[model samples]
Target: MAELVLVTGGSGYVAGWCIAELLNRGYDVRTTVRGPGKEESLTQAVSTVADPAGRLTFAVADLLADDGWDAAVKGVDRVLHVASPLGITAGDPAAMIAAARDGTLRVLRAATAAGVKRVVMTSAANTASPSSYATEGTTDETLWTDPDDPTLIPYRRSKTLAERAAWDFMSGHEGPTELTTVLPGAVFGPILSTGTIGSVGIIGRMISGSMPGVPRIGLEIVDVRDIADIHLRAMTAPAAAGERFLATGEFTWMREMAHFLRDGLGPHGHKVSTRQIPDFAVRLTARFRDPSLREITPSLGRRNRHSTDKASRMLGWHPRPAKQTVLNCAQSLIAHGAV
Candidate 1:
């Protein structure tokens, strides 16, 4: 009998790939959805990569509520807690924090009670970054961002707090279930469905020419497939327990990414603009045009990058080139008619 792995939030961009990769590896997979209606979309998405057949199943669960978590964790050998509230600008920052921090605890409590062998949680790279990204250096998992820093964005604070809460919960836990975390940066790659692109939506917008010009921002690109691979490695690696691994690839600026899309996609890439938007123009636009732009204004000239040497050394993980990842991402968006 194959070991059953439970993936929280099955209908997510990263979670969908995790499920497909697990099914391809011959693991019987079960995933949590907020409602029964979402099951069809998840099933359709996962089926695109691997034949779910009878190996894939779904459970109703929500991070904001604790109703179906117990049942979701029951009988699972391992868990990948990939579900969390994410937004650049939230109407209520505290609510986002509560959902991320409190919701993580809910999953941990259930996993510990069920005696699951291991739980690999998905965390963002921002959780391990400094408050100011102006410093030009490579940081590792050893550095922990201060979530209480008022300068931190809501999403960054939520992710940092949630990961911190998970570690704190395990510190006092006497259970046999082990915990590990995989922190990924700017997840990009093929989209399983057009419904749930998550942060990869930025690439979609770029490919569709939604933005007039590129901002002076950069991202440490990591493929969605690579992120899924790291999650599975963390779940099974003995050295991964009670450890956090940063999964990041080459850092590329928005201008470079725009150029990549424009040169790589041929006719389809014609819409992608390689022109850089002035930082002052972006700041001025944020003042009245869009409130969400305010959140990213701080990162207009980000210079820092993350070191994934820990993930490479410990788990023997290696990510594909950033150009390949970016080109594939744009191609995927085009194929899916999402652009």
Candidate 2:
């Protein structure tokens, strides 16, 4: 019998790709959805890459509530805890932190009780970043972001806290289940569906001419497919237990990404503008017109870069070029009519 793997939040952008990759690798996969209605969309999206056939199944579970988690993990050998609350617009930071931190514990508790062999959780590269991104240097998994830093955004704080909580939980845990985490940078790649693009939305916005000019922000690009690959590697690798791996790929500025879209996609990338927006203009708009812009304003002149040497050496993981990822992202959005 094939090993059964449980993936939380089956309908997510990254989770959808994870399911496809697992199914492609001949694993019998079961995924958690908030409701039954989400199964169809997840199936449709994953079907684009691999045939789910009899290998794919769905379980109803939610991060916010304790219900259905045990059944969701029942009979599974391994777990991929990919589900977590995320948003760009800062609302109540406390609520996001609670959902991420408490929700992760909920999954860990269930998996430990079920005696699952391993659980690979998805964290963010920002979680390993310094309190200030202005510091120019290469950082590895050894660095931990201070969650209590007041300058930290809600999303960053939530991810950092959640990962920390997971480590803390496993520290005192006397269980058979092992835990590993894969931290990814800005995830961009082919979209299986137009449903929820997540961070890939930045590419869609650029292609749609949503912004008059590009912000001075920079991004460490990682393909969604590569992110999925790292997750699977973490789940099975012998050296991955109780370790965290940074999965960042090539670092590219928003301007470079815009230029790639414009030159690579031709007609499809017609709307992409490489014009750099003045930092002052962005600050002014963020101050009054849009609060979401505030989240990225801090990254205006970002100099920090994350190292993937740990993943490369331990798991033989490698990501594609930033230009290719950006071009592919734009092409996918065009095919889906999302731009």
Query: Residue 299 in model 1: shift from native, Å?
Result: 1.0
CA RMSD, predictions in order: 1.3, 1.3
- For 119-208, candidate 2 gives per-residue lDDT tens digits of 999999999999986788999999999988888989999999999999999999998999999999999999999996877887888888
C-alpha positional error of residue 237 in candidate 1 after TM-score superposition, expressed in Å: 0.6
Candidate 1: tens digits of C-alpha lDDT, residues 82-198: 997764225788899999999899999999999999999999999989877577788899999998788888888999999999999999999899999999998899999899787
* Per-residue lDDT value at 314 in model 2: 98
The CA lDDT of each predicted structure is 0.91, 0.92
What is the C-alpha local distance difference test score of candidate 1?
A: 0.91
lDDT of 2: 0.92
Q: Which number leads on lDDT? A: 2
Q: What is the lDDT of residue 119 in candidate 2?
A: 98
